[model samples]
Target: MPTTIKEKTVLKFEPVHLSDLTKITDLYFSQTGIEKENTNFEQPKLTEEFGFPIYKLVEGNLIIGYSYFTVNSSEEIVFKAIIKPEYSFGDLESRFINQSKQKYLSKKELDRKGMKNSIMRMVDWLNWSR
Candidate 1:
């Protein structure tokens, strides 16, 4: 038997939502193993906030992985995870992150924003670990 082209799967990205919390946490636990104990994989308070863009990869009804991000008081965007080793960001990085659209800053830049935002950085990383 041969599979039809229409049956092939195509992955797409969408914003993470409250409904996806469980699945995302599971993947985080699975991907990070026991390291999940102290992590914020189950907490989405900030990620659930506005401007904190979290995107997940979906193929049909399945979520493959997710890209998690956060914004600090510096107004710089922090990328927490592009989770999954096989997640090839490619050109889709622009779909989710546009340097021209926002004052996107790397983790290094966030370091200079001050210790307060840096602590927020740590917490945000914990939340996005999954």
Candidate 2:
């Protein structure tokens, strides 16, 4: 069975296992209404090599949302969060930020530097309304 998080449960950083990867993939396909494919299977490999972490938002045994991260170095971490299709983006964003902050705070000094750089780069992806 998949690990469960209680309602309003919050987590910072937790190690991810192969089982979690399977659960996450299942959740992703279910929520996105997409079929699973074997193409580009490097994500799981990357996650395993770098000690990526996964977090779940659950109500009882049912996962409501999930997030994961990949840390390439002390200062570089990439995060992805997904929620049920019926949920709002605001909810996912809030949870992601909360979890990220926790992970950042707990990271080693070198890792923190990489994480900051990654975050700064992420800002460039956003469009500013004029």
Candidate 3:
């Protein structure tokens, strides 16, 4: 395990393109493993691409994780997140989440709700699996 999360690692959040789904699926399966006792998450389907927005969390040139979320009546509900095993430390997760929140809060289209009142439901999938 890393002794400490990389200091001020510049994280970039980018939308996942159709071409990226294969990589996402591969990583998800690798991280979740194939044990029968492990929680089984539905494999992402291409037909359901329009259902939610997925963002890949990047540090420099490497893609460390990905998150998919949908907005409900009261809050932004994060359906799932898959982070690489090596970069799954709490500090990195916290930083990524905070940045994601800020990105959503700053969206001009969501101004009607007022950023302060916007709610975000975070799911720590890595720990939740254990």
Candidate 4:
């Protein structure tokens, strides 16, 4: 029998397990949409050894979402986050990110190299209108 989490509960962050990759990928595609036929959705290499720490959001035993982030100095740079649509609610993403920041701050060292890159370096990718 398949178990589902239909009610909102206290959520916690846990390391993204190998078995959770499929669920994460499905959520990503579902939210982002597959606009192109050749859109190659590669699973991230979840590890802090390479500076990216990925976590799965769980309430009880069910995985509801996953976040990928890197800590640069005191800042946590979130590369991607995807939650099951049913669980997506106002402030949920921000709260999850803040929780991730707290967890990573205590568990890993900040990336000094990432800190060296300034916002100006990413000007081309930013929209001034926004």
Per-model TM against the reference? 0.45, 0.46, 0.47, 0.54
Cα lDDT over the full model 3: 0.54
Q: Model 2 residue 119 lDDT?
A: 38
Residue by residue across 1-130, what tens digits does model 3's lDDT show? 7587667767678977756655665565566663323356643322222223357887786777876544455654444467797778877666665666566556635542332233121122322332
Q: What clash pairs does model 2 have?
A: 74-110, 74-111, 75-111, 75-113, 75-114, 75-115, 76-114, 76-115
**CA RMSD for every model?**
8.2, 11.9, 10.0, 10.0
Model 1 Cα shift for residue 5 (angstroms): 6.7
14: Cα error in model 2, Å: 7.7
| Cα lDDT tens digits for candidate 4, 37-126 | 344653332223122326888878888887765444556554446788888899887777777767766876766456324332322222
Which lDDT value does model 2 have at 27?
72
Which regions of candidate 2 are displaced past 4 Å?
A: 1-18, 37-51, 71-76, 104-130
lDDT of 2 by residue, 1-130 (tens): 9999777644333444445655655676666655455577422211122223356655455565676554555545666667666553556657664776576457645464555544344333211210
User: Against the true structure, whose lDDT is highest?
Assistant: 4
C-alpha positional error of residue 130 in candidate 1 after TM-score superposition, expressed in Å: 14
lDDT (CA) per prediction: 0.54, 0.51, 0.54, 0.58
Q: Pairing residues by index, what is the TM-score of model 1?
A: 0.45
Displacement of the residue 80 alpha carbon in candidate 3, Å = 4.8
In model 3, the worst 10-residue window by lDDT is 118-127
